[model samples]
Target chain A: MGFEMFAVFPGCTLEKYSSELKEPLIKILKYLGIEWIDLGGRCCGMPLLLSGDSESFREVIRSNTDYLRNVVVITSCAGCFRVFREYYSGFMVKHLSQFILDLGFSSFPHKVDLRAVYHDPCELIRCRVAEEPRELLRRIPGLSLSEFKLNRESSTCCGGGGLVKAIFPSLAVEVAYEKILRELPQDVDAIVSSCPFCYLNFKDAASIYSLNIKVYDIIHILGMALGVL
Target chain B: MFDNVFQTYKLRLYEAMDNSFIRAALRRAVDSFRINRDKALKRYSDVEDKRLRLIEVKKHVLSNLESYVKQTMESIESNNSYAYYAKSINDALKIIDEVIGSGKMIVKSKSITSEELNLNYNLKLKGNIVYETDLGELIIQLLDSKPMHILSPAIHVPKEKVAELFSKISGENLPPDIPKLTMFARSFLRDKFFKADIGISGANAIVANTGSIVLIENEGNARYVSNTPPKYVVIAGLEKILPTLIDATILVEVVSRYASYYMPSFVSIISGPSKTGDIEKTQVLGVHGPREVHIILLDNGRSEVARDPLFSQALYCIRCGACLYECPIYQLVAGNFGYTYFGGVGAIWTAFIDRELHYASLIAFTCTLCGRCKVKCPMNIDTPEMILKLRESIHSIKLIPEPIRQIIENVKKYGSPYGLTNRFL
Candidate 1:
């Protein structure tokens, strides 16, 4: 792969809630021979936007825009990716799936036999990043990808967007449960997501509701496939 | 104050969640609507083009709202029909009261505009009997419950509940079977249609050039509601006006397709009261349909919404209710997520039309801002964008929920919503 420098924006949820994802993400990038820098941890202002505090959101935007002006930023967090794409300008923003797809890897280092359904995060799907994540999952030789009944633009939310989990926690879990029951086939080995919020919500809901299904972030699956775990 | 509102709203949402009947009904309805809408849109390849064109048509009408309102009124007058402009909900109620006196029997098709006016309650207070002719609407009326969905008003009620409700009403044990329940409602409401002194219906689109009120429905109820009575009245928002009949036709098509109907069974274009020149070239009115036709063009905050750049797109909605089916929050809480309207688009409508900014304050936060509603809307109204904007207004008033306010404060203090530094670093 050609040398390209990228900044990895580990948004708040990934930094605080699902830090397990960070190592695998960095290892995958390193194994792909890409030069990357960590942008450190910061709030993406999505919570502020959700709370209707545009003034604070603008302040955060001003500081972050100035800081990330010079680099091609990549993030695994859907909410941060959305805030960057919609609220910020003059900087290139790419979801990690899009970034990985752009790098054009030919094959996975190892074949891992597993069947999983891909959950499209609302923000990334709306940003038209639906196909890229699926494309990345497809590249793994032995991993079988099943689709949610409502995928792509019509994908159902996992009930974690717009600060729902923070404010209306039970309602969010119920919505996540509905998505699982209605959209997911029972036969899949696991459910995978590209967004940290989605990953956390699905994991929490599965455990709380005592659902037998396992949940994994797409990076973790990729890490396993690439022998980087 | 914010806490009280948030608590009350949360209580309602929790209640909705606990109702397994609503959950089951919503899940089934949402699934059916998606499948039916997809199938309906697939039959017409030009649906997208028509939607884009309808957006332009709505934009044009909204820009020249006063002109269209004027032209439509004039055309209706020339067609021997009465036209009344109501600047507010009270004005609309007063007009209806004057036209429909005490002790009159009124049959109505489903009209969300009337819901905005609280028309049925006010009409009943004046010693008038009002009947909702649409089956779902009748079910809601009997239960004295607010509509849960725009098109499917009683969508939250399962068939078994309907059987129980109908069985009580009929003094006979009715089966949970759909056809039996529908037949019971039909036989019960059939009398009102024949004996009604007045018929009231809502317009899907009002034509400015032709002075026509276009009604789209699957149940034959609206046809009877408008034609069976001696007096007919149309209660519609001023935003429903289109420049021409052709524009209205396109809107009707778009609404039906997105409303999950291949084609609505009945499309009524009422130009005026029933008239005929069959008697030796002399024009005479009231042949078969209603003799007196009244068009109540309701402003009711729509003009204000149209004037505001950010909220003007909300008026482009045709009330197809596709967004409600697609909304995750709505799928869970149903109509509890909104004030009067329901779902994301309903939040915008509630804020502006209902003029209850405080209620909107509570309703706005329930949305996940998923943008699925916009994707499903035929008008492509960016509801999520409007929601954030509504939230900004709500935030200024300090009505944002405490937890959300905490998230904002935490972001400011800790550079993270969780109020913690990067432990991973």
Candidate 2:
């Protein structure tokens, strides 16, 4: 695959609850003149791993790898990026943030004049791709980024990983509440994260706590800054 | 099926969340531990290499647990100390009863193994007055509260609460001053140590080569308990064995680094019954420490855990409590997150030892499967992986929460986690 050719793995949340993340993401990629195929929605086998169905997880990875063969795969979800890069080796799977960084965007069509704090997804941090998301955020003109005291490798979990939201919502909410209380600056308007699961969780938690904060996937914010969405 | 357990767990969680004091206390404790852990690790320039070496040592020991146990038992016999294998908690208690015969007073240092066996309650029922010598354990023993943290048993209790609990025992109004509280506990426990007929302590690492036990602690009480009593009983898990004293020494470094981030105030290495040949060139037991040192190696499903390929790493835990301070769920619920032990590692151990499927299911599912515990663990025990394996077993039984089941089914059917492939509102 050439630099312009790519296949997109939007992941489960991106296909459904976070479809809004897709349009901005696609627009930004199109703006960069990168021709990409929409591989549509697919399970990244994380839920399978979480549920202790490694057999099914392996089977899923095998088939996903077959579909993603001979293509540069761009993943919107940090969870998907992790499973693809770690578990599947056939395709060159890169996080959308890392892909954008590689594209080397020198200027944006529009500046996103908003103060945002970058929340590192646990999957990305654990995989050592934390810098990619931060670099993506930094490229946005007129956007000021405030970091949590605990960021990168030591960054707190967004309380959304490991399918906790489905089974242990209360515990997940408490975790999110604690992370926000401890890490988030009170002045930030938005909590920008690289994972859809994290985005959904922070958004839910913001409402639960009645905090006037908007949560966005990095693609959404970056796309907004580029006047793509 | 586990509705009541989940209810109780949620109640405790909500109560913990509501209690500002407990949350703040946990945060402060974790911050200090993390800082200290970093400080302690900074002392060793090759800290990561040391951790990897410790991991290898534990892995090798766990894989050949039976051989190590045999070696440890033989070494203990050679040292003239009695070693017995207890198949169960009841068997261990029975052995203790037989050993004691007529002895009553007991002073015990901090031992999660003893907690696992509920030794204090059983000893008390047998009419043996048992005193917990560790300050945290003593505080919880007085308050009749379960241990919230592994290393710091009474971490959930604030200083003012400790002051309150101590004041009641002292029969005087005590200020919330920490030093005053420490003095009260010290004065209260000093007599018990001298009066106790037997001392019971847990082994951090049981050296198979020398048949010795290494105990790391900050308080002088463990030494007092082990040294002052005429008879000493060590109740340890069979999984505590190390191949040699050299390995055990390394473990002491690992445990202390992970536990308190400092080489503890004392690291007690007890080989056998204390012997002295001072008056004559003839050795005699009961010279300074205990006359008879009886070691009861408790199995209590450790063999079953060892047999399990997925969860065998659970045995690698040195009980440093590093995972607890690093666990997100534990930071919120404290000890209430688990039954006997605390955090993700505790959940795995409880699942194996408790033998109740419903109980284990509830505890196992509560873990978020975050890998922070894995990163922070000295042994790199993949507790989240173990929990997931437990969850998989639970999933087979269809005991998973309804909401979770729905999501799983949704993902299976609709190719989306939420089960909606259609347009969103």
DockQ of each: 0.67, 0.50
| Interface RMSD for candidate 1 relative to the native interface | 2.2
Off by over 4 Å in 1: A1-5, A27-36, B280-282, B421-425
Which digits, one per residue and each the tens of the lDDT, describe model 1 over residues B41-97? 999869899999999989988988988899999988988999999999989999998
What lDDT score goes with residue B153 in model 1? 88
Q: Estimate each model's TM-score.
A: 0.95, 0.93
Compose the digit string of candidate 1's lDDT tens values, residues A7-114: 889788777755487777888888888777787677778888888999999998998886787678989888899889988998788888888788787688889788
Model 2, span B1-425: residue lDDT tens:
46766667667777886777889899999889888888888886465676789888877877888887888899999999999998988899899889975449999999999988888888888888888989999999999988888789888899999998888888999999999999998999888998899999998888888999888888888899889999999999988988887887788788888776667888889999999888778888898789999999999999778878888898888888888888888888788778887777777888788666666777776777668888788788888778878888887776666666676666666655677673212
Model 1 chain B: worst 10 consecutive residues (lDDT sum): B416-425
Error at A138, model 1, angstroms? 2.3
Mark the regions of model 2 whose C-alpha exceeds 4 Å error after superposition. A1-5, A54-66, A185-189, B101-103, B420-425
Q: List iRMS for all predictions.
A: 2.2, 3.5
